[model samples]
Target: MSITTLERPAAENDGDGDDGTGSGVGTDAARATVAGGEAPAAPTRIPSKEGVEVGPRRRLRESTLDERFNILGALVAGPTVATLLFGWFTPLTGPIGWVVVAFLAFIGFYILLVSLRSDREEVKDRVLTVLLISAGTILFGALAFVVVYAVGRGSVALPHLNFFTQTMELAGPLDGLDVGGISHAIVGTLIQISIALAITIPLGITTAVFLNEIGGKFARFVRTISDAMTALPSIVAGLFVYAAIIQLITHQRSGFAASLAISVMMLPIIIRASDVVLRLVPGNLREASYALGSTRWRTVWSVVLPTARSGLVTAVILGTARGIGETSPVLLTSGITAVMNLNPFSGPMISLPLQVFDFVKSPEPNIIARGFGTAAVLILLVLLLFVIARLIGGKGPGQLSDRQRRRVAQQSVDDLQRIAARNHLLTPSPAPTTQESSP
Candidate 1:
């Protein structure tokens, strides 16, 4: 007769050789012994161990309640302690000294508070964050001071309508702020910078394209030359134009000569900046263009330039800013002229910077006020230029305008219609059956 034994579940096995959380190996051995076959030699199994330990959960970016309390305490203590030390014990005087000491105390207190709870790495991270924030605040504060100072001193001259309309050609040195304006310098600056941009934009972008698209030993040489020239002194550019163009070609100081000098300074900046921008264009884009059998020049014009247009505009803006503020080059090449000279090729022109320099040279208080006003105007002009440049070329890659979107939609429709027509024409027609009576 055959026999079958019902073994107990491993949950009942206690202090047995199969020791890993009731795996039931003891029950299997018992069943095997009950069967009519010789029992198999006992197999060894390594007990499973849960050895992995999860570390404490913490967030790097988020601030804890304890951290917030620490910061608040430090802020209050830093200023209070610094004031007491300065007022009662130390010889420190002035707002600047108080602020300096307070900031130092703030840092020290913050470190101590943070160290109480956080480990070394966490303390270091919090300290670095405070330092970075303080540095940024100081930088912004200095910028604000400059802007506020300039605008405040110049505000006296900005109220009058005549300040925007009239020129210094008629007004004397001792005249009131309303009587004279930087109109001549404004017009002269516009013309000179327009000419300079005209010269620089084409040459700069072309040179940048050459460096990226058609690179060779000559391209490397050009890049090196551009790098060297980026740091070239403005005075040297002025002298170069002073000798080469003013002395030889124009034979006099003129707005045209000033523009040449400005272009010399601007060109290298544009090329180097543009090259960096172009290098950021993805290699995949160029390869795709090539895959479509596009010529190198065509691919650059359509694919690369459009993709990096905004960055190129930024490069141009940097060059423009650098060239516009240049006093020495404009002074050396254009010379000063009080009257409006629209013709750049023949006569002298005075830009905003040069005009400011001229105004400050006069010891009269009114003239000094005019100088400040001119500086304010320059700042406003620069801001306006930035706005216009951004408007012109601010679109990022793959972002299309409404017109472009409509055009793409129309193209897709046309392609679909054409594909449908081709499919219909290519369809096989059924063979005509022979007429065989009623068969």
Candidate 2:
């Protein structure tokens, strides 16, 4: 190969050296070629030294407007003006209306969350996501307050023993009417919820398993329809049950009708919840079971279900809670009677929620108070169901065995000892080393 020495260009010695490190030879060759009246070929790029930069890179700065005050001030002003104008045009209904409006206002405030503003932007998205959570708490607290206030006011009319044992005999004196109890409503609620469980549990779990585990295109379609069914109104469900059984068979309300209606309403919720929980189970568990020679159904029943049992229990509890409070469906499907009836297959039944509706609608103040008592009982029952669900999930303190606890304690002690030994070794200790102790 012919050798030729190329002279470096003036530009190569310039300040651009800081920008074009490691490419000095290429720059020199290009300069010599240009000097020889030939077009300079493309310069070869030398890999720059890693992590060393000679100069700061240029950056573009964007201009932004300050609209925090103006935007928020406008948001407040618009609502205020509208509320004033509308209140003038159509009178405000009172505290209830204001509370509802405040709730709606908080929804708007919630929408402002997840909104981005650049550094130069003056808008402050002041954690409106927290508003959604706070609004939910406020709504629930307000509800609780209203119930407590109503109960406190109504308790004066509620006779002491009458709240528990007697049936509503709407005859005789008003004092006699006060002699009735919620035993019938309590029995009805339990029977109805039980029947609903019997109808929903197996079918819902099977359907959920099929959809989540073995589902194909058709199963997916069925799941989609089931999800849609969850949103169906309770009254509509009652009407469907009425049309299916009452209109075709008896043309009358009964406990069976109520149970069927409640089951229909509950099925979608159970399936959806169970399906989601089952889907959440790690695939590895299922594979492990199968690898150990377990069949598909056995794998599901033993491994998959157990792994996701806690969530499934929660799903069942939630479904029970939803069905327990259903008034419209039970009202349409089961005739409400004050007397206690236990047979779900035969006879009219009365649930707590339906009784509350009937009792509250009655002209009698004592009946209204009884309605509040029923509501309180229903709330307590739902809360109890939650507690039971948590317990059944094996999260109870009693779930820990003595041996397991002892093991845990021993492990903790060992860890502490290890830590202490490590610290002693790290420190300049006068104590003999392990080698010295070995002798």
Candidate 3:
């Protein structure tokens, strides 16, 4: 072999090793010789430590006792505890034990149904929803039961017309007495609520309108003030009215004073209600009115107000209901009296709440029963007001008169079709052909 041939073989071996193109031991051996004198050794592997398996019974017992107790403890210590305590113990065993037990039983059953584990997500959600609804229903029922119990206990004297007309007439301890009617209290409640509505509605509606429709620095300020008013306590309202209108403005306990106090109590509610309703009015209605060249004020007055009129009325009615039963404010401004007084500007006023308060204080069982009867009547009156408000004010002309809505809908369809035709959006009916033309 020549020198060239020997160098050629060495270059080929080096190229194979450098390029890592050869799988033969020649390349591997060359590499090993160049890097060191010997090949590298493989890494040592260590064995893993083994664990002894527990019996199935022990494993299951551990899972059940540990996880189940953990979860159960969490639930018992959480909101569920409150529910059980309130639903079972507070209402059932104390003053109103029967009501509490029933409430708790309902809650427990509902919780059990909801707590059932399921594979279906929708089913689980639905179960939870049903449980919540059942709980709410139970809670409400319990509350109603308590109210009914109190009222029923108090309503023993309700059947007699005298209950409505009578006042406290308990004279001697032995010879239990007969009282007069609650006509005065009834009159006072009506008068105070009416005045409260009258004072609150306009002020509230205007304030709400300004806040919603006319947003500016001043409007924002007014809204902030109204929000503050919403949190004011009834007692505070009474005190304010007592200090300002009753003592400072005029030093006499009269229906007017009571009205002023109630008005104060009602103002925030009406403002908040009207604000919510006004805000709910569709922006499209406002824009449509503006498109017709209507002024902002006119558009708001005619279109927006009318559209939200039902809701606004409901708000006012709700506010009135809230103001009607308040005793503290009325007590501060209008001293309690048995005689009926309709005039708001003069004389002491007796309201149902005040009557109930008075009777509950009496030691006689009959008077206490009378208080319950009064409470029931008060609740009835509130319900009546709600119903009337719905009938008269909440139902729109369209809803109240189905025929009118049908007529309007029919007229709208005709108008739309005519417009569509005028716009060439639909093909006109084919021209009629004479019978002779059939030839």
Give me the overall lDDT of model 1: 0.87
Ranking by TM-score: 1, 3, 2
Whole-model lDDT, candidate 3? 0.71
Per-candidate Cα lDDT values, in order, are: 0.87, 0.73, 0.71
| TM-score of candidate 2 on Cα atoms, chains taken together | 0.63
lDDT of 2 by residue, 1-439 (tens): 5412223323445544323443454456666777895655543332325433233333335222433443454457546644764577677667667656655564454344324443323223333434555679889999889768756755754556766676664422255445667778887888888888998999999999999778799998989899999999999999999899988986777888999999998999999999999888889888898899999999988888877777888889878988988988888889877677777666788888998888778787666777787777777778887897787776432356577799999999999999999998899858775755554
The prediction achieving the highest TM-score against the true structure is: 1
Candidates 2 and 3, the one with greater TM-score: 3
lDDT of 1 by residue, 1-439 (tens): 5311123233433555432333445556777888966666544433324331112234568878898998898899889988998899888789988898888888899999999987999999999989999899999999888778878877888787777787888899878886878888999999999999999999999999999999999999999999999989999999999999977887899999999999999999999999999999999999999999999999999999999999999999999999999999998999898888899998899999999899889999888878888889998998899899988995888888898799999999999999999999999989999988885
Please tell me which model should have the higher lDDT, number 2 or number 3: 2
Q: Comparing 1 and 3 by lDDT, which wins? A: 1
Please report, as a residue range, the 10-residue window in candidate 1 with the lowest summed lDDT: 47-56
Tell me the alpha-carbon RMSD of every candidate: 12.5, 15.4, 19.7
Per-candidate TM-score against the hidden true structure? 0.80, 0.63, 0.65
